[model samples]
Target: MELSFKGMTALVTGAAGGIGRATVGVLAGQGSRVWALDRVGLEQEGVEVLTGDLRGGVLLEEAIARAGRVDVAVLNAGICRPAELEQTTAANWDETIAVNLSAVFHHLQRLAGVMKKQRGGSIVITASTNSFDGEAGLIAYNASKAGLLGIVHTAANELGPYGVRVNAVCPGLIETPLTREAFDRPEVIQPYFAALPLGRGGQPEEVARAIAFLASDWASYVTGATLFVDGGQMAAKFGTWTEEKAEFAGGRWRLKPEP
Candidate 1:
């Protein structure tokens, strides 16, 4: 399926981050006029950058008004605070929920209204595999991500009548700045990626491509769906790689060479 966005306008939040940056590049390369929003300022050719916090909802409104019409909206802004339930601070929990879940809700509400009037649009959310699993050391992050499904399902249901589609991409162990520390440590990824069928972590561009597809016309019939951009990690409950058949090196796992 050809994912062409020629003459369309796309808005991406968290534009400075890994997945968000990649999504902006994908949309722009596919011929869409892209507007990127984030707390940090961004400088990219042919892209409009909106700098501000997602919590306020003002920047979101500004992007919409300036773009004139949003054919696609990638609600990719989020924060992950890793702390065990006992250690998770109230401030951290509130902040994580505000950015990851609350911001999305406000943005989706505004986007829905705009798209409903236009009678067509697509909204792709940045959910995570943690949405389904209770990963240790991420009490707040997991909860916030899990809450996104409620938003995705409800939005998709209500927006379908207005010709607007809502969906989510759940990425697992992607090599983004948020995960750079984990990827840098061989000890961390060796055991973690061993559970994945691909034996490696995914890149930002890979997730971006998924987001682009869901935003594009190729997914016209797909809505209220949660697309897993994970490397078979969710499917492998017990993991597939083993030391007898595979070797861990270079921050990834690989099948051992035959003698």
Candidate 2:
């Protein structure tokens, strides 16, 4: 089935690269006028790139105002600076919250008003698997992501009456420029590969597809929900059984008792 947003306008943050960039492309492909926001500028067909600091909230507000009638809002801007909890400074923690959580809250607050005026709209926030699971050296990142879910739930409840839907997309280990170095290192990505039921990482477009679905009428009934685009990583975490691997064959890890 084809999803169309022919007359819709979408506001996408972090549009320069990664899943944000992919979501902008996807929305534009569906004929939605996209307002792409990021710290650095991005130039793409069918996209009006807006460059600014999300922390300041000025750019975000400007983008929302410029959209005029935003049918969909994708909150995808975030930063992950890895530092052990003990080594994490107040400055580090504040910066993370400013960009990841505060910025999102501000955007949602403004978008909620616009959508309320329009009488309806969908808001999709890009959360992380860390929102559920704790990572060793990412205390700030983890906390910010977890806080995002609270925003999603609260916003959904408040906006529901106005026909505005709010949801989050929690992505697993998706390969993106931000993660390129770590993804290229076997030591960094091998464990995720083994734990993921899909036996591999995900692509930005994979998560972007989920965002588009939530933003579109296809998920009209869905709100206050989180769609996991983790290639089964979360499922693997809770699965009762696992497929045993026999031996490496045909340049692949062969499963025992193959179905």
Candidate 3:
């Protein structure tokens, strides 16, 4: 593969996981001095692992100090829980938003300050296919991801003039620790795996490559876009009438997706 970031610097949040780790490895391989920030222990050779919470002010500062200048910021660190709407509590909602959406805002607030002076930068947020289609038991995950796109669009437009590009990558059922348990759960992901058109889940590196391209100057004109990396899952058709949320020309309140 070609090295697109030989002299650039990158900051990858959640570098201990699948997408983040793959990103860290790929960027570092391409000669970018990477600060792989995560809350978990990452024993990688080329990475400078900063283990801390992204929502914590101090850790963010420390990571920036270590990175010196952030040219590419890939906000890939996020958590999810399968709590139904009724079981979702205020605390869970707040934490989910904090880690997923608020933390992205926090990172952007700081990165904008740095990049504004540096004159330009790139930001890639790891959103989810959940943003496109709703899941019954993952209200918090779904809502927070949807909020991430709002941030992406607003930031892209607001920061476009500054030469900074902001975009979102929505991955569908990628292979990661986050989805491992669910996929392994005989009661859950196994049965639904067939519902996916590709007949298999995607690897984390697949998502990482797309994010790498978006963060590079190769995508100089790409911003404010949400790229769906699912294997045709979003196009699934759902059956007959479900209760509508609002009256539309299609006689449906919301979209009915099939698998």
Q: Give the Cα lDDT of each candidate.
A: 0.94, 0.88, 0.82
Task: Report the C-alpha lDDT of model 3 over 139-249, residue by residue, as the tens digit.
Answer: 998999999989999999889999999999999888789888765665454335445554456888889888998998889999999887876667656422232421222
Instruction: Give the Å shift of residue 110 in candidate 3.
Output: 1.0
Candidate 2 whole-model C-alpha lDDT, 0 to 1: 0.88
Name the weakest run of 10 consecutive residues (lDDT summed) in model 3: 245-254
* Candidate with the greatest TM-score versus the true structure: 1
Candidate 1 per-residue C-alpha lDDT over 1-259 given as tens digits, one digit per residue, 9 for 90 to 100: 5679999999999999999999999999999999999999888999999998889899988998899999999999998878899999999999999999999999999999999999999999999999999889999999999999999999999999999999999999999989999999888898999899999999999999999999999999999999999999889988889999998887788898998
Give TM-scores for every candidate, taking all chains together and pairing residue i with residue i. 0.98, 0.92, 0.87
Clashes of 1: 0
lDDT of 3 at 106: 88
The top-ranked prediction according to lDDT is: 1
Model 1 per-residue lDDT at 144: 95
